[model samples]
Target chain A: MLKSRIIPCLDVNEGRVVKGVKFQNLRDAGDPVELSFHYQDQGADELVLLDVTATRQERIAMLETIERVRQRLSIPLTVGGGIGSIEDAGRLLNAGADKVSINSAAVRNPDLIAAMSARFGAQCTVVAIDAKKQGEIFQVLTRSGTTAEAIDAVAWAARAESLGAGEILLTSFDRDGTRSGYDLPMLSAVTDACSLPVIASGGADSVAHMVEAFQHGAHAVLAASIFHDANMTVGEVKQQLTDAGIQVRNEW
Target chain B: MIQIINTGVANIRSLQAAFDRLGCTWNLTVSPEDIATASHVVLPGVGAFAAAAEAIDQLGLRTAIIDRINHRESATLCICLGMQLLCESSEESQSAKGLGIIPMAITRFGDGVKIPQLGWNEVRPLDNGPYDAGEAYFANSYRLETAPDGWGAAETDYGGTFISSIWRGRTLACQFHPELSGTWGESVLTQWIEGITC
Candidate 1:
């Protein structure tokens, strides 16, 4: 049986783990390696080290962090943030990242998804979609959800899959840090839109939210706040999911 | 010491980390001598079939690996694409030749299921196989549908039943990643290191 993956995302800036309440005012959490150990100890299937502020030097810091953290990691690790080109993806992969996720760059030039997928194999090319629910539709946002785009979230996901993205990281900007729960309708919409596996992200406060995301058709649920705040371990979440009759990997 | 055959396509850092955590001594090698002479060899791979097959040949590891396997003195563990490389051939790359250890065809997952099936899938051992496999992480588009002759296998269900791991004598090849699968996965590496020959 294929299980729904539980991923804990670490918002990284300048190589340090930072958790921002709604993408504003970054606060240090801990070293990425330490936090990674924390999550994996609770049986996290994978880790996403998303570089929040992806400047030139910060990108290098991200690489360094990946290098150090990877030595300690046993599971898969995904590196994202300001990955503007194939070279950037290449650098991260070379630095020992198992996969690379593209956001703003993929939106600006959708072809990059095809190129990276072709170059690195579709297995490692992830397209992250930051979206906010607008009236009657979900609108895609960019640059850490500051700029709203005319692109439809569901439509972009379908296009991204067609353009060769292997997976979609659909984050809800409207619900992020709100503890409101995953945007279920938005999640199901994107899942229905694309054939690729969709990872539900943002605004999860409890195990029920994760269960809701899975029931809504997420192949995986990526939550940050709940894990970071010590509200639940990845083990606890999976235990609850299993109790709720959702198939989650328990042998790990 | 375990010699990990690095054919340039593999992200071996995590694999290496797994070994280190196990307190196992290992080395990354493209050297044929190392492949031929190591007590055990781990062929770790990531990426396309043709590219990986080409890299093995380019690094002059072809005959070396085959000879080592034939000798049956030690063992070789193939991981993911490494396992695919052991097959007769694949639908993915028509022109490329496999090492032909498994003597089976590798085909893509059906249209109904997602391609490049990522994340974890349950793995069960069959016919007195060495490892239990136990919910391993997988990331591949192509898979072996059935077990070949003279080998015990661990199977997984997706679009249908597919062989996830195969064991013969002391040798093992897994389609799923034991390195990235945490506890049970690390135990797979440990048993391989402990040399629990079937």
Candidate 2:
């Protein structure tokens, strides 16, 4: 069976891996490459390197950091933050990123999804939608989940899939860092709206949450704090998922 | 001397970077002019059938690729979607026509499996296959249902049945992403490149 994936997200700023409590007051985690290699060794299925620094100087630094990480890790690495054009996607992919994720840029230029899909192949292109619960709908939020937009997460996910995005990385701002478990309702909405694989991010507290994410329609689960704080290991998470009747990769 | 025919699929950059890491000279090309002079060819893609087939047709790379693969018996390695394109057709999209070099048909994994078979998978080699069974990366919705035409070198199990890999001949392919499949995947590329150069 197609095994469910467990991915570790590394937040990078100025080429250094940084961890923040509740996405604020960032603290240096370590070198991006070393941290990524550590996760890979710890049995992470994939690594998502989000270059949180959006400045031009930071982008150059981000690219250099990406190059370094690419040389070190052998598994899939996805980089987001400040990705705007197909050319940018091309450059990142050339630099060794297995996938290029677009959150804010994808919202601004929806057509960029199709263009990147055509140029880089859909599987290598991911549309990450950060959302905050707004009554009955999960409103898409940009700028690292600070600004909420009127866009419906489900609707945008459908549009993204139609535009040829291989996968949709859905993060819930409401539950992010709360460790209350993933927002099953919102994830169900996105999964019900699109046929593409969905990666559930935010609000993963324990191994149970990881297992529940897959049960609630997530093809893969993305977690940070829990993994970063050494609460649980990727191997343990996979083991838990396996115990819960979810197909997971055993040999890391 | 090798040209990775860009038929507008994803994962080209990874292949290019892998080739770079291996110190193997290659170019990403879809033009006939480039294909004509290439000693070896690589067809790399990552997407559904409709888009991939459409890209090949739109770029008019079908003929150039066919001419080179058929005439020179040029060594070709098709990764992931590129491997699917080597088949006769895929169920992902009805309109998607494959290169038909390998006599297989693409089909979707049943309800037991997820849509996109993402993550690392193990490859089991048959006796006298191209490479021994090892871990290979995969991310795809549909897979080639039947075996390859002349060579059925390797296979992998997703949920039920086994999928083809290292389906060697002048035309070779694997549904897994060798470029991202780690050291073993790179070794497969080295073997393929060496086979072609030989």
Candidate 3:
């Protein structure tokens, strides 16, 4: 049986990890490579790096950061942010990213998902959806949540999967950075709508929240602030999941 | 020097980075001459089996690789799809023929389980293998029925037990990506390199 994955997401700007990570023995919290290695040592099943800085020059810098990080760690690394074309996905995959996530661009051009999957295989293409709950419907947001589209979130997830997206990174704008818990209703809707693996992102307050996400049908749970602030360690989260009878990759 | 066969399917940079960390000299080559002269060869592949097999044949590397691994004592390591390419053929694409060095057929994880068996899983070494059983990262939908006899086969459980790694004579192949597996993976590569050099 395949174990559920616990991933730590790092936002990188100008090749440096933003929102400084607090680790006791970490010499430089700004270095993405060091931070990734730190998280891997803490038993993170995988790492996700979002190139927040999408400029051409910064993209090159992000590639260099990926190479450095790839050299040090063996866990799967998924890179996202500003991937608009097959060329963009190619550059990242060649730079050593095991998978590339597509978000805003995917919403703008649905064919981009199919193209990437066709070129790099579906396993390498991940579709990230940022959905915000409106009156009675969930609206898909783009441009880092500044723009909202009329597309239904649930329907979009199913469409993305049919278009060859191997995985879905679902983030709830309503719950992001709130630390309350995952948006269970929204997560369950998306997971139930698609057979593809859904990675529940956005709000993750505690270990219990992760277990709940898993119960809600999430194949993986991704948290950034909780890990960045040192509110909890990856080892602790894995232990909690194990105690809850969820199978996780046992690193320790 | 180790020559990594480039099938133009995916990047070999990560594999190169792995070798660099171990202080090993390696280069990416599609030329048969480089492959013929090298003491060690690593074939790293991705994408479809038909496309990759076509690339190997077009580059004239199929004959060169088979001749070296079968005739000479040069150590050869195949990773992921490259490992699948060592068999008689694959179910990934019809009309795609493997190197035929290993007498096995590759097939996909059928209905019931997820297609692409992604993420990390525990690998158990068989028959007094050098390394201990450890967790390794895997990302493929297809698998081999059984590893050839006399090969040090290592199995990993997904829906059922499958051959994850195999070592026979100078030929070694792994269904998982050892270069991207982390510390344990790096150690495995180091051991393979040492086995060839020392």
On DockQ, the leading prediction is 1
**Best to worst by DockQ, what's the order?**
1, 3, 2
The TM-score of predicted model 1 comes to: 0.94
TM-score of the first chain in candidate 3 relative to the native first chain: 0.98
lDDT of 1 by residue, A144-245 (tens): 899999999999999988888889999999899899999999999998878899999989999999889989989999999888877777888888889999
Q: If you assessed candidate 2 against the hidden native complex, which CAPRI class would it receive? A: acceptable
> Which digits, one per residue and each the tens of the lDDT, describe model 1 over residues B1-198?
989998887767778878888888998899999988889899988888988899999998899998887675587888999989888899999989999876778999988787779999999897787776487889999999999888888899988899899887778899998899888888898888788888
lDDT for model 1: 0.87
Question: Model 1: chain B TM-score vs. truth?
Answer: 0.97
iRMS values for every prediction: 1.3, 2.9, 1.7
lDDT of 2 by residue, B31-143 (tens): 88787666678888776677888888898878776676666366777788787787778887776788776666888877866456767777877646566678777877787
Note the residue pairs that clash in candidate 2. A1-B158, A1-B159, A120-B10, A121-B10
TM per model?
0.94, 0.82, 0.94
Model 2 scores a TM of 0.82
Q: Ranking by TM-score, best first?
A: 1, 3, 2
What CA root-mean-square deviation does each model show from the true structure? 2.9, 4.5, 2.1
Task: Point to the candidate with the largest lDDT.
Answer: 1
lDDT of 3 by residue, B1-198 (tens): 888998888656778888988889998899899888887899987667888888999998998988887753677888999889888889888688888887878998766665577787888887666466777888788898676866778998877888998876667788988887778888778777776421
Model 2, position B42: C-alpha lDDT score: 83
lDDT score at residue B98, model 2, on the 0-100 scale: 82
What TM-score does the predicted chain A of each candidate obtain versus native chain A? 0.94, 0.94, 0.98
If the candidates were sorted by their lDDT against the true structure, best first, what order would they fall in? 1, 3, 2
